[model samples]
Target: MFGLILDVTARIHYALRGLMPTNVLLDALHTRRGLKWGVPAMLLAVPYALAAVFCTSQVEAGGSGWFNLLALIFAWNALKFLVAGPLTLMRLLWVLGREANARRRAARALLGEGFGPELVEEPVLTSRRA
Candidate 1:
């Protein structure tokens, strides 16, 4: 029952350990917190990503290529941290939220002993990543 949810979160935390920030991993198990951190992270990331891409295009075009090397590296890492990291957190949170909701509903139905409620035999598998 509720243990399943905790189990899934633990697995995710274990797998993602040291690969991302602790806050992002913690947020991945809850929707509201995930969105609160993820949205701002995503918003802050766009500029860096855009800057990286634009700089890359400029370098590829052979215009001031060498001069933009430092900027390119900084922007690339920033995009990876600010955009990709938080995006991963948010997606994992979404999947976990859906599975949790399904489990909760199933538990409620079982407790109420209501008929016509479909039983969840196992935790739902989702394509989301941590």
Candidate 2:
């Protein structure tokens, strides 16, 4: 169970890491290090419990024990998504935040003080549909 959990965790963590904006998730979770991973893991509980039912049903239907075990493992995979996915994404953002800060600091150092206001925020480009 532990190995299965870890394997699924590593796979899904890396997979979904790039799906959303890092800064946004960081703002939502309010942590540079990691936070979003916490509650979202609870979502896995549903799929896991469902998989458990599937596994038991397979058993009752005379499926191989190995198949039941596989189902249980897959269910745990769902749980792992709940655990590691959000956290991994958040941690990835923190890593990105660290790099971004480093670059900004370097730029400011080169610019040598009095570089007023955040430079070049998202530009508002308004265009009407043709």
Candidate 3:
């Protein structure tokens, strides 16, 4: 029974994930190339924030109570984008550092076994009269 419940929950989770529009954007932002653009993407939050403010004003002006829901949604989206930017930047730096270390380790391995820089001989030049 527990296994069946877990399976159903996982299926529902994935179904909901597919329905969310932001899932695609979030997935792209997590990638290596996408990480580099995260700082720029933060600008997207500005529009969301503006929309939220507009909705809030509409609600306060007695436009409609439903405007409050829109305001909350916009606010949440704005916060998500604002926070995603810095998090992605930090992740990008960590990935770059890891890659650099891996490359250094590979190079050291290639230069191992009597192939140290000190063991390399400089080319000797000889002058000859033609």
Query: Which is superior by lDDT, 1 or 3?
Result: 3
lDDT of 2 by residue, 18-88 (tens): 56444244345545444545465456567667878888888889988887776766676666555556666
Give the TM-score (vs. native) of candidate 3. 0.78
List the candidates' TM-scores in order.
Answer: 0.34, 0.42, 0.78
Question: What 10-residue stretch in candidate 3 is worst by lDDT?
Answer: 119-128
Model 2 TM-score is: 0.42
Could you give candidate 1's per-residue lDDT for residues 1-130 as a string of tens digits? 8999999999998787657553454456345445455544556556666777787778778878563885666575566556645566668677779978978886775646543344445433333354
**What lDDT does the true structure give each of the candidates?**
0.62, 0.62, 0.82
C-alpha displacement of 81 in model 1, angstroms? 5.3
Global Cα lDDT for candidate 2? 0.62
Q: Highest TM-score, which number?
A: 3
List clashing residue pairs in candidate 3: none
Ranking by lDDT: 3, 2, 1
lDDT of 3 by residue, 4-97 (tens): 9999999999988767766668778989889998888889899989999999999888799999999998898889888999999999999999
